[model samples]
Target: AALAGQRLDVAAEAASRARALAPNEPDVHFLSGKVALARGDLDSARGHQERALALDPAHSGAMNELGRIRLRRHDTAGAIRHFINAARTTPGEHIYSRNIDVVILRTLSRMIYVFVLVALLMLWVPAVMHVDRFPFAVGFGVLAAGAVASFGLVLLRLPREARGLVRRTLRTRRVATALFVAIGGVAVAFAAVAFVPPSELPQTLPIAILITIAARITATARLRSPVSKNQRPGDRMT
Candidate 1:
């Protein structure tokens, strides 16, 4: 009731009493987290949220609140992961599902930036390894087009409202995100030559598989890295 009224003092007081009465109750801790969030006490909010999750790992409510706390901390990846987990744990919630789609689309855009880098790296085979430059250019163009189409298709899977939300959310991270894209682009460009084929496009299927493995490994590392705090599972960095 106090929480609904936006009365932090009363909420905190009630939550404290509830905690004392039900020390191991996830809902009690979640209430405490809500009170802390109402007071703009992120540290306390995070603590309580973590406690709630610890007590009940499948607590979708706790996951949702924790995701918001992560957003407040500028931890976009963490927030997205939490939101995704909340959606997966409770598939009927439209809000969580919508949030996940927005984040996923934004993240896909970032990855497309990286893949462009990877493509530049992969282009070396036709440019240097292949004797004919025309076919190499054509095939490289195909790769670039494929990457772009893939990003577009992913967006098309989302509703128009979610696409708008993703665009708005991306505006905040424009500078930093662009910088990251450039850096990743450069790194993958360097790694590209290793995956390039020797003239024949269809002949490089095994190489394509290997390059896919490398991309997945790179993506996994980004997801698992501690570059951001308060992350839920399968959080993305790019």
Candidate 2:
């Protein structure tokens, strides 16, 4: 109740009493860890959570709390390990599964930002240098291929369980259609640059820019939509 009310001091007091009464109980330690986390005491939170896990090796709650602590500390990989353990331990828990998606989406968001910057640089540098059309077309084609390969590699590197989820998401009609259009746009842009005269190469820039913008918008929307759906009301603890 105190935790729900945002009263961290009261929650900590209650948690301490519970821990004293049941020192061996994993749930008690989990509660204490949550209270410590609420108070912004990450070290205490981590210690309590570790203690909970030691008491019960299969304690999914402890694993999930530890994941939260890791996330707070900006340890993305550590957090992912903990979350994956939690999900693997309790396969029926949708919350644990959602946590994995949250982390993956966050990583994808960062990748999108980097991809956009690199794509823009690829487009801008050649134009500024007044490179010939054929060379620019070849460079752009290479960039596009590299981007596609990098995205595929990221998916392939995901854990088997997560890889299945991502593959399903990509198979959705909307996402697949968007990807097809984006890829097609890039192919057409390359063809235009390759066949068109050097003076006409500038005309393809706007189409390329539009494709980039569309991709950013589509990716951002897709990333954000799942986050809202994953959030559960009144899920304050773990």
Candidate 3:
């Protein structure tokens, strides 16, 4: 109750009392760790959570809490590792799995941003260098291929279950259609620029830029939306 009320002092005191009363209890330690985390005491939080895991190695709650701590510390890889462990330890817990997906979505969002920037540079650099149309087309085709390959590599690195979840999210009808149209439009626009008269360059380049911008906006919007709308209380990522 105190934790829910944003009363950190009260929560800390109550958590301390609970730990005192049940020194061997993993749940008590987990609660203490949560309270410490609320107070921004990362070391205390980590210590309490580690103690909980020591008492009960299979404590998924402790693992999840440790993941939260790692995330707070900007240790993304460590955070993902803990979240994966928690999810694997308790496969039925949707919250742990959701946490992993959230991280993946954030990573993908950043990747999309980079892709958009590179796409813009790909267009601008060719013009500034007075590169031949064929060379420009070849360069853009390679960039598009590299972007696809990078995204694939990211999916391949995930655990099977997480990879499946990500694939399902991406495969949603709206997202898939938007991406397909945007990518297809950009490719077509660039290819047209390569084949059409130099006078048409002005028209084709703008179309490609617009498509790139649309792709970024669409991807960012989808990623920022909740991965699952059925999140239960206490399941929210910190």
Please report the TM-score between candidate 2 and the true structure. 0.71
Model 1, span 91-141: residue lDDT tens: 887677555644554465466556655664564555455546455446656
Root-mean-square deviation per candidate = 12.8, 4.7, 4.1
Give lDDT tens digits, candidate 3, residues 45-81.
Answer: 9999999999999999999999999888976567778
- Comparing 1 with 2 on TM-score, the higher-scoring candidate is 2
How many residue pairs clash per model? Answer: 2, 0, 0
Q: Give the per-residue lDDT digits (tens) of candidate 2, residues 1-238.
A: 8998999889999998998899999999988999999899999999999999999999999999999998899776677678889988999986886776566666656666666656656666555787776677778768777777887877766666667766665665544554565555555544554565667658877776676667666765655653234333112225
For residue 73, model 1's alpha carbon misses the true position, in angstroms, by: 0.5
Off by over 4 Å in 2: 7-21, 38-42, 71-78, 152-157, 174-211, 226-238
Candidate-wise lDDT, in order: 0.64, 0.72, 0.77
lDDT for 108 in candidate 3 is 62
lDDT of 1: 0.64
Which candidate has the top score in TM-score?
A: 3
- Which candidate has the top score in lDDT? 3
- For model 1, state the Cα shift of residue 154 in Å: 16
Error of 3 at 179 (Å): 3.8
